[model samples]
Target: MFGLPRNRILKKKKDFQAVYSRGKSYANRFLVLYVFRSNGFQGKVGFAAGKKLGNAVKRNRVKRLLRESYRMNQGAIKEGVSLLFVGRKAAVDAGCQDLEKAFLALAKKAGIMAGDVEFSIEKRKNCR
Candidate 1:
């Protein structure tokens, strides 16, 4: 029923801490991305939206948007990596497309995306 399995989600607090401590980070207006190379073949992802963003509903909404953006664009991301996406307060006002753009831009800046491919969200929409 689910495309992304449980293993693909970074669930442990230690894991998040490790990524935060060891990983490199990149940020835009919407989100902050922390990327760390992993030993596994598949990438693992985690999302964070703080209380500062708002109440639980608002935070969850931000998380949902971030997750959807990641799920859609995960194909273009490099394998063997751990990614943590922390949504900013501005993200509460951002749409999915804006979040996706922010995500991809940060991933590219972190050098975790393949350079040979042209990673454009617009092109991806037409292909689908």
Candidate 2:
């Protein structure tokens, strides 16, 4: 949708571990983001929500929100990179717009994403 194209999502255990171990991390109100450059043609994005966030349902809901946000905002991402978004407990109760803002904010801060992206969520609240 929009100008964002279909890109592969990161799913391998090794990849996740590498991102956690090697990438630089940035924290926001809703999520902890880790970014790494990869050898692929497109960027790979992953989401992780621990049990501390809540039960499976709650965790999955946070992941789903992140996934949707990432999908819509993928056009800002560069190719051949790996990004991992580890959900914070606060994300379990966050709205999609809020979470999207937090994710993009973190990405921008990390310098992996360039230019200003006017997302659907306009009002920037206390989203770190």
Candidate 3:
């Protein structure tokens, strides 16, 4: 339940270019989200951290945090969209929860998430 399969991940230069060119974007202090909708079954996602963020280690760490944020809440996203998440400089020191909040807020603003969905990744046992 916590897996982001390879098929659902976007990793090609051309693919990233396509999304950037045709997508509508939403941004906040933490992230810039580029969203491109398609007529496919599963939506694809890509994460990016630029050199401005810092050294290689810092960049990769930000990317990993972004990936985990997306992975955990990916179930609430709509199908058939290409989502490119670019991390901002502020994200270098931000934690996963902060990133996740920024991501969901942007998705909500972009109308990319499933309608009226409660974004709870935790599975609570029934008290019955």
Give one digit per residue, the lDDT tens place, for model 1 in 8-81: 88888988888888888898889999988868524889999999999999999999889888887777777788
Whose lDDT is greatest here? Answer: 3
| lDDT agreement with native, every candidate | 0.82, 0.79, 0.84
- Total clashing pairs for each candidate: 0, 0, 0
lDDT of 2 by residue, 1-128 (tens): 44333446667798789888888899977999998876751477778999999999999899888887887777887666788889998898888888888988888788877566565665534232
Q: Against the true structure, what is every candidate's RMSD?
A: 3.5, 4.3, 4.9
Encode model 3's per-residue lDDT on 1-128: one tens digit a residue: 57988888888899888888888999999999999987642388889999999999999988888888888788788877889999999998887778888999999999988889867434323100
Error of 1 at 9 (Å): 0.3
Give TM-scores for every candidate, taking all chains together and pairing residue i with residue i: 0.87, 0.84, 0.88
Native-to-model Cα distance after best TM-score fit, residue 36 in candidate 3, in Å: 0.2
Whole-model lDDT, model 1? 0.82
Best by TM-score: 3
RMSD in Å for candidate 3, one decimal? 4.9
Please report, as a residue range, the 10-residue window in candidate 3 with the lowest summed lDDT. Answer: 119-128
- As for lDDT, the candidate ahead, 1 or 3, is 3
